[model samples]
Target: MIYYLFQWLDDFGVPGARLMDYITFRSGCALVLSLFIAVIFGRKIIDRLQMMQVGEIIRDLGLEGQMKKTGTPTMGGVIIIIAILVPCLLVGNIGNVYMALMLIATLWLGVLGGLDDYIKVHRHDKDGLKGKFKIVGQIGLGLMVGLTMVFSPDIVMRENVEMRNVENSEVVIEYVQEDVKTPQTTIPFVKNNNFDYSWLTSWMGRGATAGGWILFVLVVIFVVTATSNGANLTDGLDGLATGTSAIIGTALAIMAYLGANIIYSSYLNIMYIPGSEELVVYMAAFIGALVGFLWYNAYPAQVFMGDTGSLTIGGIIAVFAILIRKELLLPILCAIFFVEDLSVIIQVAYFKITKKRYGEGRRVFKMTPLHHHFQKQGGIVTALIQKPMQAIPESKIVTRFWIVGIMLAVITFVTLKIR
Candidate 1:
């Protein structure tokens, strides 16, 4: 709203109104405004949740201080959602396709997660929404994002072509004259970062392009579902998911800015995604919201994000990466979420196989969701790799995970130069 107002004022020759024309300026403003909203309004929301008895239902997991968090307010993700949406609406160019997609993703996941949390808290069903139902919701969101990308004419990219300056002995890259829609994405450690999904359907010949899009849509569905669930699972410890998401959001913001800029896209030899710079403003708000939420979400958490925040955060990251053609980098950039997700899968599969073979259930980790595994004391469960005899402090664990997340973000950015 403020953005449009500034635009109108700029038309009338207002001196400072033109500042909104710069992505950096608008993004900065969005960041500050989001932070202000989250911090200032967060306490009141938390108070309301407390008054309504919207506390978490904790099962005794036997980890240190586990029971202490039982009554902490849950579903505090509403604060984050409001903070993020308000700033974006005020400062973001909502007309941009990428911005519109991001806003859709936020609301879609927010509602889905809010429903899940509502069931768990209000209905007193610890299982919350049925697993199948959650999966269905995720699939529905994936389809929405995937189909939009396929059909939206505004979403297009220019392929960067490299040329040799024979006389000057320098290499130069140039963007094509026309923007083309393709299922190409950035892949790390390759001289040419472009990886076209069409390559998988080359046997189709004339129909290969269409087949590639179908495959791309499937990939989008899978990525969105997996990452969103990964985040939900990683929300085991205070600030673990929130801090890591903020880091990931920062990296995505940088990627969006560079991909949208013609000069940077050419220099980096990456796809030039026209009009993607608007995503920087959206992401700036995202980062601010998470950080502000962290004010209460950190150690000795005052409020829990529940599914409301985790699912939305993951969906945002996935969609943002897809928009900037950087989804291929998520495995590395989002390694923490992936590892947390994989730990649960491994533990479950190992337990099932062992039980079938030995007639008794065995385990891999003391608990699932890797973060909780570190918080468990050694020798308590039959598991592999239990060398850490003492449980690590929750605060320490979150900090270490955050450090790892930071390292991953840095490495992700370096890949642009390495390629």
Candidate 2:
């Protein structure tokens, strides 16, 4: 690991060894290194996948440009996984609990996804691994993350309590006291952004605080499942998941930086998470990896990420937000993914409900997953609610969604200062 080597070199009077001391410098280095790895090695990985005949099994969706993607390589998520792990191992503090947790999450979900992809490609099952197994894996991951946060000594938060009064009955809150492990997370746009799960367990009386861990674990499970599924649904088009994930990663990087800085955390009246700054280094690597992978993934994708990248991306985002105590912001930051997930649920539920009453199945959108709905041909006789006058090109749809993701990222950060 470069970090330890440089750290030891400092004792030997090695010049510029101090660069590792700065989070900014280390993060920048991580970005560059990861980007280089993703782009340079992406081609080789794609070739290997091609040699192995690991290609995507495209289902007929009848959308424009759909067949063109037939036989394109899938499971390119290896590129991202390698890019992130290498940089973090070389430049990051491996001993930091947060870093360790992130590494585990990345690899854990990545392996699960890789397994699913393997089943699909080798076993010739388009359905891949059973749905129950995937849920079990996600639940397992959530359990690990939840229990780790509850029990880890290094995991803790600084509470922000109101300190002074301001105009219009507003009070400026200031964070105080030593960091202690708690089930508290930031809730945006509220005066005191901190929300503790123990409050929900007030019925426990004097022991309510202890019961908060139980409540928090449930919330972690829900967050992990929802966000990961949301991301998985969003990986439908070229550059859609990769580009949107890069945006989310960038916003998360800012949150990690601010949450770890005592001055910024106190000034913003947010919980201070010690050692979370290391997450910035990881996020930079994540962003770089996604962007570099996009070089080959955008428009007519040369390779697909399959569940390998999609599931890992989602899991990483969920875990990173949890570590920074900003999991509550996920709905706002990952709104696009949420909408995509919701569209399918809504459409399916509506169709089933209507079919029971009308003796025939109905539809909600031209197609589900939200993205395909936009690409569907505008026809008067279609089974669903069709609002768009005409079909949009796939490229335009992806770009527009990206623009929305960018907007959400900005607004997510803005909400912190808005209060």
Across 1-419, the per-residue lDDT of candidate 1 in tens digits comes to 88999999999999999999999999999899999999999999999999999999999989999999998999999999999999999998998888999999999999999999999999999999888888898899888888898899999999988888999989999888998999999999889779999999999999998999999999999999999999999999999999999999999998899999999888889999988899999999999999999999999999999999999999899988988889889999999999999998999999899999999878888888999888989995678868577899999999999999999999998888895
Candidate 2: how many backbone clashes?
0
Residue 260 accuracy (lDDT) in model 2 = 92
Alpha-carbon error at 391 in model 2, in Å? Answer: 1.5
TM-score of each: 0.99, 0.97
Model 2, 269-372: lDDT tens digits are 88889888899999999999999999999998999999999999999999999889899999999999899999999988988898899887778788989998
Per-candidate Cα lDDT values, in order, are 0.92, 0.91
Give the Cα error of residue 341 in candidate 1, in Å.
0.8
Clashes of each: 0, 0
Candidate 2: what lDDT? 0.91
**Worst-scoring 10-residue span by lDDT in model 1:** 380-389
